[model samples]
Target chain A: MTTAKRDTYTPETLLSVAVRVFNERGYDGTSMEHLSKAAGISKSSIYHHVSGKEELLRRAVSRALDGLFAILEEEHACAGRSVDRLEHVVRRMVEVLIAELPHVTLLLRVRGNTETERWALERRRDFDHRVAELLKAAAADGDVRGDVEVRLATRLVFGMINSIVEWYRPEARGASDREVADAVVRLVFSGLRQG
Target chain B: MTTAKRDTYTPETLLSVAVRVFNERGYDGTSMEHLSKAAGISKSSIYHHVSGKEELLRRAVSRALDGLFAILEEEHACAGRSVDRLEHVVRRMVEVLIAELPHVTLLLRVRGNTETERWALERRRDFDHRVAELLKAAAADGDVRGDVEVRLATRLVFGMINSIVEWYRPEARGASDREVADAVVRLVFSGLRQG
Candidate 1:
């Protein structure tokens, strides 16, 4: 009986395994049996750690959403001139996306299949809207171009920033997070065209 | 039975149905049964048009890839100065992506789960490399900023162009494709910052 003792899986540990499987197989493709097999536990054992597969998804996306929303509250993101604040938010978004890559990857790939995914999507839209407001303010202040529609500008900028999750590999590149952030900021502000 | 033969499905029609289903249920989550129901045909009838689900995926992605590759081969794309060529490519990409919105959407969503998906992914990488070469040429010519790596710039710009498929609704917005392309080109060449 004493030898049977193993480190009990916590929600966080179990979530890590589930997110990996989800990312690999996609959420709809993954089943509880798959999670149990990957976690080296029984289906019943998984229930003890989390309610079900959707809970794992919810938890993962919540972590990514928290990291993103935190950026909006940061001093530089809130206190600077509108364009500068927008730049701060953009750079921070790239950093957070890379830092929470897997979770954010899952968040990005959610297709609104379940209630949890729908909620995640709604929160994501809110985040986008909040950032769009910054762009609008910057435009009103004559910092950003007013000729372009505010919504269009926000979506394109977010597209550039969000796409970082698709190809950025922090472990292999040897590029520091700051380096990635700096590159994103420079490209977004000045674009590819030379002055 | 003869009535069912009134209008036989062509490979192109079948692909439209399959891509719709693939977009609805992530490709891995879709089955032959689902495709049959969506196409209003028997599973055997489905195979008569294409070998299987993978073939449908291959055809759809191929159509999208062909459109993209063709853009690079255009006289304008090939004959202009490096920066001008890059600009034309970007604008044309937005147009092609919009024109082939459904196919490109499916192409973007492929996760390399099958042999066909993997092939599609490889071809997509080849397309990216081709564009990156143009970016490199522009940077070398001093027409584009050299501060960001050509690879990163290519990805970000492609990201901006590709993200169009996610939110663009031609029917709802009453917006023509040319209008959208014009907006994208302006936004890309002119940064959000006001001059």
Candidate 2:
């Protein structure tokens, strides 16, 4: 084995490999050795890029959370009729999810074992609460349904959106991010039942 | 540690603990040592109760699959208008899912890593196909809408229903299984939009 390094792998490239392995074996099941093999680098070389396995996890989840939170700050999400804003946020979320598929997939699968995971879970709840507030505003404006509990509606809507990760294969379908986003928006606003 | 002989744990009881831990720290994340710790038994004792960790997983997922498949065989699911039968199956699925929470939770989380998981996935697909056939029948009868693809509609409906496992905590909710099932049926079929 050549001990001398030639071209160094960027942290982003390393993270791409690590997240793939983490998704395959699961976050907890994956080890440094597994990551090293997947990345085609020495175990010691991995440390040169990331502190360890959990650091990779933290970075991955952080990327996902950042993308999601960014949606709330978008102009369309910020300024519109309450229902329209809610729809925009929902549509944007699907786009971001597909764009950052691996990171978001990792975020959705967190089981809250370590401090970092617990923190991720808390932020996730906060994100849900933020959206729930939007739904409540929409309901108050008489734009959306008011009979169902806001919390329950939010959970169900988010569930439908998040479940896309389970079956959506970007490579196979050749589906553009916008197309998926449009489908999600259309389904969410209009019930499957005929109008 | 007490070296005294103890009564053997039944597969059912052992499976309950295993599914809980599996959900707590994903299927791949858990080990025999974790199971033993959770079960208050030695690792070898656990092996005596069940062949291995994967066997426990198989038993748990099998129980869940059996409950779900049994819904299709029921009188209500079998003998009715196509839409009625579809509704009956959907409602019963929610009930079974809540009643057999832990087992079903394990079933939903399987990632097809082992033979047992692959089998569970295949069975799940069979169940989905059965439901989709019902939806197609309903669409043919002009009861349910045909605007959405039957397959896509089935998946979205299933996604909405299956997500209950992630947040539905029975102990804290105080809602009966029937109540939860009713809510799910109402939300999916009727939707959150007020007329």
Give the proportion of true interface contacts each model preserves, from 0 to 1: 0.50, 0.22
DockQ of each: 0.58, 0.35
Q: Identify the leading candidate in terms of DockQ.
A: 1
Q: Across residues A13-88, which tens digit of lDDT does each residue of candidate 1 receive?
A: 8899999999888899899999989988788888987899999999999999999999999999989798999999
Worst 10 residues of 1 chain B by lDDT: B1-10
Q: Candidate 2's C-alpha lDDT? A: 0.84
**lDDT, candidate 1, B122-146, per-residue tens:** 9999988988998899889998877
lDDT accuracy of residue B4 in candidate 1:
66
Interface RMSD of 1: 1.7
Task: Kindly report the docking quality category of candidate 1.
Answer: medium
TM-score of each predicted structure versus truth: 0.92, 0.86
Q: Mark the regions of model 2 whose C-alpha exceeds 4 Å error after superposition.
A: A1-8, A43-45, A50-52, A174-179, B1-5, B8-11, B25-37, B40-56, B174-176
lDDT for each residue of candidate 2 in B53-123, tens digit (9 for 90 to 100): 99889888888999999999999999988888998998999899988899998899888888989999999
